[model samples]
Target: MTGPAAIRAALPHRYPMLLVDRILTVSADEIRSVKAVTLNEPWYARLGEEPSKADFAYPDFLLLESWTQTAGLLATRSEEEPADGRTMLFGSMRDVEFHRRVFPGDVLEHHVRLQRAVNDTLVFEGSSRIGDEPVLTIGTVTVAFRPREQLDPEHAGRNSAPLTGSQRGEKS
Candidate 1:
């Protein structure tokens, strides 16, 4: 499984921000990544109670971020050019639905399907699941692509080929 370090190498994300745990599958226009739920996650504190049960829950915003990261991985991993100098900004969210509660140890899987891509925009439908049950789903979203030079300074960095979902054992 590709850990955070490998993901960082593939994508320009660092500690406290990188969300994808391991890429699990990838094709030309699709990618799936895994995020093994852990009790030590920073967001767990907001859960009110230390997740004593396997059925612990996660906040919706965090789940959305996780799903968004998966979408980025799909675009970066499958694209012909995955230069670190490029970045994607989430433009809009549509038809998002939260299903079952996601808890620690759930090992949530994100399946991102690229619906369309043209010019510098990409639309994807993403779903997060625990095994066969879906925990979250976003029907659609449009993300804008931009050169790293145009992004905020805090988002610039370099991660080479060691981060491809195919290169890493994480699958996509």
Candidate 2:
């Protein structure tokens, strides 16, 4: 990203957990991106036992969120020209597993593939890795796209929230 603000415009992330640093590649149904981790990260505050060694690390949940946002960039843009205006929701993440750690200074590349999308629902498979070694893989995610008015205000405050859980079940 030219700056954090640039990344914010590419997707609908605010404040903390907007992990993507810049977008490397994008298509109608997929996106590839990068995130540069640094010692100044919030998550590393507690994880780093040695304050002297500000060797920051990426958290699993946030990495997942990053991947979700990457897929979101694609999912949202896939229909950028559509007559209907539906917002992107993460839906349900299944089989999300972290294999390795992305430390400070490591630029992990995220590759996301769109599997399917029908009506307001979409599914995708994504993976994050450093070079040839994989760091995280999300097997499947099923989510629905609804108009912005269908969501609760509280769900926007936290990356994960109770209201989002209930709304996911209700299908907008």
Candidate 3:
């Protein structure tokens, strides 16, 4: 079991972005985590002075991100430290479905299982529930441990000028 402080140490997310509140269980193949949703969440404050019923619902994307972060922690549990300068990046997400609305005061329980891991890529199956009631399901999510240079816009695509005809070894 892990608390918020330990979860923060495992993941890079912080503040309003740090979604996982507690880790219930962890192993080589699976992990379970918790997140207590509350009206005090940063996003809820953006609903203006008078929020409506629609504004009370948590965004689906953040829900997915929270699940992803849980899976990421499971994936990296074996490593003594983050692998050099590599970081896990979401490669793909498929067959995601939301069964019911999630709101403040809901305690989200996220369960994730390792489907496969090949080289730097890891695949997982995940779901979330609110007190035994299913709230979200994801068929598969793929994440890759990639070098920061590959993902940083400042370093990527730095020198890609189009080649002239002469540069291509053809008549100009």
Better of 1 and 2 by lDDT: 1
Tell me how far candidate 3 lies from the true structure as C-alpha RMSD in angstroms.
5.6
Candidate 1: list runs displaced more than 4 Å: 1-3, 46-56, 152-172
Judge candidate 3 at residue 61 and give its lDDT: 89
C-alpha lDDT values of all predictions: 0.77, 0.75, 0.87
What is the full ranking by lDDT, best candidate first? Answer: 3, 1, 2
> Which residue pairs show collisions in model 2?
none
lDDT of 2: 0.75
Query: What TM-score does each of the candidates earn?
Result: 0.76, 0.75, 0.83
1-172 per-residue lDDT for model 3 (tens digits): 8898888887889998999999999998899999999999999877888888888999998999899999988988744456667777888889999999899999999999999888788899989999889999999999788886555545546664555677667974
Q: What TM-score does candidate 1 reach?
A: 0.76
Model 1 vs truth, CA RMSD: 10.8
In model 3, the Cα lDDT at residue 21 comes to 94
Return the lDDT, model 3, position 116: 86
Tens digits of per-residue lDDT for model 2 on 70-155? 78777766764542445677778888888987778788899998898787788999899988999999999876777654465554
Regions more than 4 Å wrong, model 3:
78-82, 153-172
**Residue-pair clashes per candidate:** 4, 0, 0
Query: Can you give the lDDT of residue 169 in candidate 2?
Result: 81
Q: Which stretches of candidate 2 lie over 4 Å from their true place?
A: 1-6, 47-56, 80-85, 153-172
